[model samples]
Target: MSGEWLAEVVQTLQGLGLNYAFVLNPGERGAFIRGMGVTLQLCLLTVPCSLLAGVVLAALLTSGRPWLERPARALVEVTRNTPTLVQLYCAFLVVNMLITQRFQLHGQTNPLTPFVWVVVVVSLHKGVFHAEALRAGIEAVPRTTLEAARSLGFSRRQLLLQVELPLALRFALPSLVNNLVDLVKMTAVASAIAVGDVTYESIMIWSQRDNVLELLLLILLWFGLLTWGVSVLGRRLEAHLRMPGYGQ
Candidate 1:
């Protein structure tokens, strides 16, 4: 029975081409594209920004004044403890409401582009995790290595940029890529805020076709393909960046 159901679902999908979907107005393909565009845009923008934030925060945590360090640590703790969905709602919905009510902002309450909002939210959220990951990576780089570089008359900046960060990144890249894949998956939540990502489009299609099962299967396939691709790519990158003697 399950096999039959799966076969039927596959057949239905094969028969449902993009044009057919459009003609039937099933899933609002256009809307789905709009959403996917927003989602991808968010991820692309957020990833780099979040990485920079992570680097800065990690440096602060590892090398700053006690006062600065404690607050950065607290920020990571708070963000990690809270649910991401709640964070999105707070940043997008609740804060928008307050901004409108208190500030009397004239335009759309959530004035930023969906891409920008999602990116900012993702950056701040992922920043905490990445900071911890990076800090661990930085720590893994031996004190002896830094001392050796200094003994060679390398300046503070050179020791960090030339010796430390490059080595740390090799250790950090795998986790960072893993986080990136997770971030891409998390973009689905943006749909709740009307950000029009792939998942949102899938839901729209499901609504129109009344083929919830089929559309959902496609959604699964889409995400699965994306995540698998990311995994493969990460592996290649890790292999490429493997320190000559380190991995051995």
Candidate 2:
């Protein structure tokens, strides 16, 4: 019964003149699925790593020491203002070129491949945005809360760690989720460097099959599902973390 339904669906799609049979073919199916795995790997690695980077940046920005804040602020501003793709290209083409020159490895094309470049570049870019959002959340932390923590002899570090960051994260959850959604979409750019993500795989198949519309539709649906899952998860987390009195 299941096989019959699956066949019918495939037939209906084929009837529309789609070359989606690529999905049914073993070798092509493997490539496309591998592309999806690469995309998923990017999202999984980047989301948490970027969040961690954001926390570090936010701490530096709010630490009240110009020595620390100035440099961190400059980094954040530069990352936020630039295009991620350009950054990816520079890191891959320019920096990777330098690395290759310095270390002449026989069988390697630099330790940093397109995957590493995408992860680092995307994480830093999204991290700056996350930091700015968290800074706002940190500022919105109640003055009374700070005073209470200080009255209890909490050191500045302790206050930030125990009091401010927790509340700030709660405040910034929505923005963080939105950034994550954007970051997932941003992973598509990995294809530009031949990382062979889902987008890249789709391009390969369509270029060969000349079924651009079919592949394009699949790409959109693929990304749409990923972003939708992220959105749902974020909303659920926001609800679970809702403070009793803060919103009220």
Candidate 3:
């Protein structure tokens, strides 16, 4: 849409007591747009990474070896037990501090941006929940299914990959979706680190304009759209991957 037409719509909304401060203000508009870009980037990058991490972590947890299982279990316990904000602080303030100090002697710069920190931290946090959910699903698989796989001479790894994981995924889909939805919300914590996400942008604009109500409404609408999109995508996946005569 053209700027003028958008401005007209903004004017109309203003009459209804919703002042979208960024519509006519170019500077605030630019900052808010940048924030939106970061938010979208977080959603796109973190969700897939978390899923991959979850799969790997779940495999580690069920690998039947103390060496792998112990570390993975510790990771899950630490991540799941802590607040996301604290995790972000530890990742950015603490870990990044050490990285910077370590690299300073070599004249090397820190490799990651605030954006990457948020992505890694959030992915690990949500990944643990996904791992747990999948673990439960794996345990819930019927005895007959395990027997059939064993009867076919399936090795432990082969059985997990070929037979168990597929069914476990179906069983865990709902919980995974819920985790992902929360993952999207967790991306908001990026704002705390000055990543310029939508929430951060909204704060900037509203603080300058003293229009908290207006900005909050828009923020809610924006996040509502994002979370709704995740939900719809999850529902479609559940339907497409649904197993007949199971969980009916």
Candidate 4:
């Protein structure tokens, strides 16, 4: 469609209070802000948690114990093989139900809030993929580097912290950013559990206004802006972290 038509649609929607932030209703505007906040909060929470879990899982997968390593590998494979939506649903409905019922905590406050559960599940699901990325990066690090660190009296922790992880992280940075971008988009699934995220709020607004196109456009704009900004920032940070000896 043409820019003029798009602008006209946006204008008409704004005039009819179909836009995300309806000026006529303070409550609707507040809800929109809250939803945006929730989306941001989910992304921020999930990214770090997923990255950390991925690193730990990668370490476990690479370790010497056959049982632990095999199981870790299997878990990663299973998680990667499963569809994310099914995983989210099963994790939310079935696993969550089992946990609540098994603990006899039905009457008690749920330990996992809707927001927390969204972050936790998304992080863990993405963590599987990230684990593979990190594991590959770790393996790509030269064995000579580890031996060099050992010969220099570096402890295991020091070797990992100073030598392995840094180099591995550099190699994994682009993939990690890609994973984070996916994680941000996946936050839309939070709407399924009534998390009051952007998508949920947009749906509610559109239901009342009967302006599906307007609401959807706003959603697209918001997501596009957010993801684009994130990509730009990631690229800049990646360049800043580039190793002098490493080729682009």
Candidate 5:
């Protein structure tokens, strides 16, 4: 297509308030959709991994063993304190570079692709928040309840797995949901390391088309729906898991 004609078409689309025309263009649409897919995949993978890591970290922090507890606490502190972008940079540029050099794989891609790096960094970053939230929940469990479980011959593992974790999860549900919502939004940072998530794709699109506002609006709407859905789910879980005669 001629440059003038392309410009006219884009202008017409914008005039009609179809600022999102790029999303409808077959060529551009594919890129946008692919980016959206990557973002979703990152979220799907990060959520579960981060949650599991958070639980483990929280367990270790409360384990009463100085060796395990100190290291876990330090990890949580460092990750939570540092900027996520810096962490991603270090992971991609430093850590991945070392791995690439140490193991020469001709014609084979590195096992830790950009996708894996993003997942690892984002998970650990948010895992700290999850750990903190869960730690509070664990502490919130009534001492009386723990004593009763102990009196009933519950082993430490049994008490934690059956009694403490369940109740703590219920207590922590709201904060956990908030952290998850933030985690979904934080996936946008993956674009920094060239992970090709929605934010990255949008940047590439707007650079050529100059439709920054329109594309950003779409990004905002997409993330809004995602975070809102998470909030709704959290509320439902909170309601369902609420203890009888206890405030939700």
Candidate 6:
């Protein structure tokens, strides 16, 4: 009985000209799984790298030194102002070319890989937002806290790292999580550079089978699931870090 139903369903799908069988094929599945792996790798690597870069940039911007602050501010401004796709192109084509040229001068011709360039551009692009969030978080720290730290003879470094950053992170976490979700979606742009992420592989498969609609729906489902997971995790973290008796 179940076999008859399954056969009818397959026949109906065939009559509709939908080739889900292509998606189930071993080669196609492998390509998609590999692409997903690359996407995940990009997300995993970009999240921490961007966060660290953002923290450093935020610290520089708040350092009270014109020399450090100006350049950091400029970087954040330019990155935020530019489109991410353009940044990826410039990093992969122009910056990588320059670096390769310089290396070639020393008889070393090491070109940047597409994966590296994508990770770098995406991280830097998202890092600008993280920097602003962290900066706001830092400023949100009460002045009395800084005074207390100073009274305890904590050095400037200790005051910033120990006293300020931890509290700033909690304040900035919601924004940070939002940025991470954006970063995961932005990984789709890596396909433009032939990094073989999910979007790229999907394109390849759909091109061969002319199953663009099915592939697109699958893509949407995959990204939806990924972003949904990130949101759930962020909420849990926010709850865990909520200050007792505050924001009640």
Candidate topping TM-score: 3
Residue pairs with backbone overlap in model 5: none
- Off by more than 4 A, model 2: 1-8, 105-109
lDDT of 5 by residue, 117-145 (tens): 99999999999899899899999999999
Superposed model 5: Cα runs more than 4 Å off: 1-13, 16-18, 105-109
Model 1: per-residue Cα lDDT over 1-248, one tens digit each: 75566556555866774223442332365676665576667667777888898988887787748987999999999987898788888887776667667655554454565556677787888888888888889889988998899899998668667887788888899898889788778767777776677777767666656766666666677667667777888899899999888869
The per-residue C-alpha lDDT of model 5 at residue 21 equals: 57
Tell me how far the alpha carbon of residue 187 in candidate 3 is from the true structure, in angstroms, after superposition: 0.5
Ranking by TM-score: 3, 2, 6, 5, 4, 1
**Candidate 3 displacement at residue 134 in angstroms:** 0.4
Tens digits of lDDT, candidate 4, 1-248: 55456567657867886663353456776787788888888888888999888988888877767987998988898888887777778888988888778667546655876777788888988998888888888889999988989999998668767887888888998998888788888888999989999889978877887767776777788878778777888899889999888875
Residue pairs clashing in model 1 are: 27-204, 27-205, 35-196, 35-197
| Pairs in clash, predicted candidate 6 | none
Give the TM-score of each candidate.
Answer: 0.82, 0.93, 0.95, 0.87, 0.91, 0.92
Model 3 agreement with the true structure over 94-135: per-residue lDDT tens digits: 999999999988999988889899999999999999999998
lDDT per residue, candidate 6, 1-248, as tens digits? 75566567656887987666564467987899898899889988998999988999999999999999999999999999999999998888888888889998999867678999998899999999999999999999999999999999999899999988989989999999999999989989999999999999999998998988877877888888888888999999999999887678
Cα deviation at 52, candidate 4, in Å, is 0.8
Q: In candidate 3, how many clashes are counted?
A: 0
Clashing pairs in 2: none
Residue 230 error, candidate 4, Å? 2.1
**Per-residue C-alpha lDDT of model 2 across residues 21-41, encoded as one tens digit per residue:** 676666777898899899999
lDDT of 2 at 231: 100
